[model samples]
Target: MTEGLLTAKAVMERLSQSGQRVVTAESCTGGLVSALLVHHAGASDCVEGAFVTYSNQLKHSALDVRDETLARFGAVSAETVTEMAEGALRAAARATVAVSVSGIAGPGGGSDEKPVGLVWFGLAVNGKKTKAVSQNFEGSRTEIRWQAALYALQLIAGYDE
Candidate 1:
């Protein structure tokens, strides 16, 4: 939380200053990214909207994540998150940038391929190119979600660079 304060504030301040708005699509982080952005003052100037698609149905319905993508790659894949970010951008229309997160954060559901704390992030900015990154953190469910949120904020802050 402390680590993300400066980054989240800087992200909102920079986005607001540049007159760019941000939208978020979330899964395992469950709107934690949006919560972090909205925590700071003046965030309304930059934040456009956010969706907490914790279920695959909502991921497909709300963020337009493709059914085939979800079937092939599952909910926690880069493909799913990329689609989630792009879907958010297209749906919101007003936002110039968007970020999406999906992962497995739990004391259970840790597979050999996609273990717990394994998170995939997608960033779409200026409609140039979308970027996706996969990260694995070690902690309780709460800590993993917090780390994922912090990383999402960092991604948004770096999108301009």
Candidate 2:
């Protein structure tokens, strides 16, 4: 199996064993993370749902991302992803964990400050402190999105609770 599918399987097994369900909030990676998770058989047991909030307006309307947060920190910042993850968990009533991804996976639309392939990840678990991390990958847009989805799966698999 490919690495992304393998990671997704591992996340599924982990969540099943822990009796936890996961939800996803995606931006630059779109629904790739959710797609990977659902590729595994019986994903419904572990995957609560996914929100592909590609636009800032959807991020606010669907995931309840604050306009102030997006304006101040930008959509791909740690703050925005943190809120995304938390909002996903809150929106998905059955989800115990949420993973949020936002990035500049592109051949264009990149500034010197936030270059292409710069991805931010957020992990929110029930009763635990939410966390955010950023990675600067180097590759085509597809590759960057794939890497971000894989990393998001890894985050779900590695969650202690």
In terms of TM-score, the best-performing candidate is 2
In order, how many clashes per candidate? 0, 0
Expressed as tens digits, the lDDT of each residue in 1-161 for candidate 1 is: 76777788888998998899999999888888898888888888999999899999999998888999999999999999999999999999889999999998998998999999999999988648888899999999999999999999988988877
lDDT of 1 at 135: 97
TM-score of each: 0.96, 0.97
For candidate 1, list the clashing residue pairs, or say none: none
Q: Considering summed lDDT, which 10 consecutive residues are worst modelled in model 1?
A: 1-10
- Give candidate 2's whole-model lDDT: 0.93
lDDT of each: 0.91, 0.93
Cα lDDT tens digits for candidate 2, 29-144: 88998998899898999999999999999999998999999999999899999999999999999999999999999999889999999999999999999999999998999999
Off by over 4 Å in 2: none
